[model samples]
Target chain A: MGGGITLEHFLVLGLILFLLGAYCVLTRRNAIGILLGIELMLNAANINYLAFAFFGGARYDGQIFAIFVIMLAAAEAVIGLAVILAIYQNLRTIDVDATETLSG
Target chain B: MLNSLAAQAIFYVIAALTVGFAALVAFSRNIVYSAFALVGALMGVAGVYILLAADFVAMVQVLLYVGGIVVLTIFAVMLTQGIGDLAVSNRAVGPGAGLAVVALAGAVMLYATLRTPWHLATAVAVASTTYGIGNAFLGVYVLPFEIASLVLLAALVGAVTISRQDTPPPADGAAEKGRS
Candidate 1:
């Protein structure tokens, strides 16, 4: 803990965040809750990308990919929320389990 | 030496903020609380980006992720009803199974991460990444940049099309019967 921050430290932090996100996604019944978990997972990945970029000769590629990921995440959030709204309109609930009409 | 120590302290604080709020987001019983807690988690990630010398990406993370997505999620939560029923509304299903799955995945990922012999580069002086990033986006990464814009446009149209109330909701029973 006294030593300066290292790549492993960032990697471990990301691992914890990713695992928490996985747990959130696996357990949450609410659709928005699942989306929130996905966001956390994506952030964890972004942290890894920036960490590698900083350490790997400080190239711009990692940051660029991170920007793209953020862009895609925004698109995903928009579409997902819209779908959730649509589901709520029809079923009056945003529970993932309750919207399992396609399971048949 | 003192400077590095201070940096380490700051890193620990930011790490705590990030992991702590993330835990809240994942485990909070109230859906609204989960949504709000996401702001803290995301902000802490931005702090992480800054620490990693990614100023532009950090700002973008703050702007897009914090300003855009979390607010949209909160809106979605408020728009839907039954939000007051905190106990059951944000219920967890199959906690034991979820824990088992996460633990297994965490173990594999942590093992790989720790065991890898990474090729490390000497630390370079921190510089503004905005100029280089802008050039790469316009020059080498132009195609992907254009494609991203197209994707955003498509998302805009699709969201409006899907969520608009003018269209009638699909007949659930009929759809299920048809599918079967």
Candidate 2:
């Protein structure tokens, strides 16, 4: 309170978000759920990047990197959802647990 | 100062919105709920970007992540049938193990975050970053910028290719028999 908001505050917040995202990825059976988790994790990383950029000199590098991450995330979501739709077309279910053809 | 206090309050509110909705996204039983909760979590992150003075990134977050990705997720959730069964649709596996892993990772990350001696400098004065970002994208980051556009084009084409339904079999008895 005395120092107002510190870097640690943002760092801790990002950490919590990352952990929750990890939990989501680890526990969820649906592929889309896992994708949701991934989005959260990516955002958590972006938070850390912006936080550092803000506190470490306010350079544009971190912001640029965050934008790239967001772009890649958009790509990933499109590809991932398309794959899920493909799986659904063939198997009729989007359950991650059910799609184990590669497990063999 | 009163200004700092107000900033702190705003930060707290943004943090609460982010973490609370993230929790809902992680733990909600319905995939639809999780997808929708992600909207809140993402918006909260955009707020955090604003708080960090990244106006351009914040707007991009709203435009891309919230506007595009969340809607795409919701559409995916609806397209897949059997969404009404809340119990099995978004079932979680090994919650006990997941909790253990999260705790371990959280503890490690928290310890590292608290113990690290971060080199901090006085933050730059808040200003419009759109100009600086545009310049950087065209100048020092030009190569990567081009590469990103390539990636997006590839992804766009790949998504269409992958999701396109197989051409309906020719409306012929022989074609229908072969498809079956």
lDDT of 2 at A5: 89
**lDDT, candidate 1, at A90:** 90
> Each candidate's lDDT (Cα)?
0.90, 0.91
In candidate 2, stretches whose alpha carbon ends up further than 4 angstroms from where it belongs are B1-3, B85-93, B167-180
Lowest lDDT block of 10, candidate 1 chain B: B84-93
Candidate 2, residue A47: how far the Cα is off, in Å: 0.2
Task: Please give, for residues B88-130, the per-residue lDDT of candidate 1 as tens digits.
Answer: 3334458878889899999999999999997778788888999
**TM-score for the B chain of model 2:** 0.88
**Model 1, residue A96: displacement in angstroms?**
0.9
Off by over 4 Å in 1: B1-3, B84-93, B167-180
Best-matching candidate per lDDT: 2
**What i-RMS does each candidate reach, in Å?**
2.4, 2.2
Q: What residue pairs clash in candidate 1, if any at all?
A: none
How well is each residue in B48-142 modelled by candidate 2, as lDDT tens digits? 99999999999999999999999999999999986553543334458888889899999999999999999988656888899999999999999
Each model's fnat? Answer: 0.79, 0.80
User: What TM-score does structure 2 among the candidates reach?
Assistant: 0.92
* Pairs of residues at least 3 apart in sequence or in different chains that clash in candidate 2: none
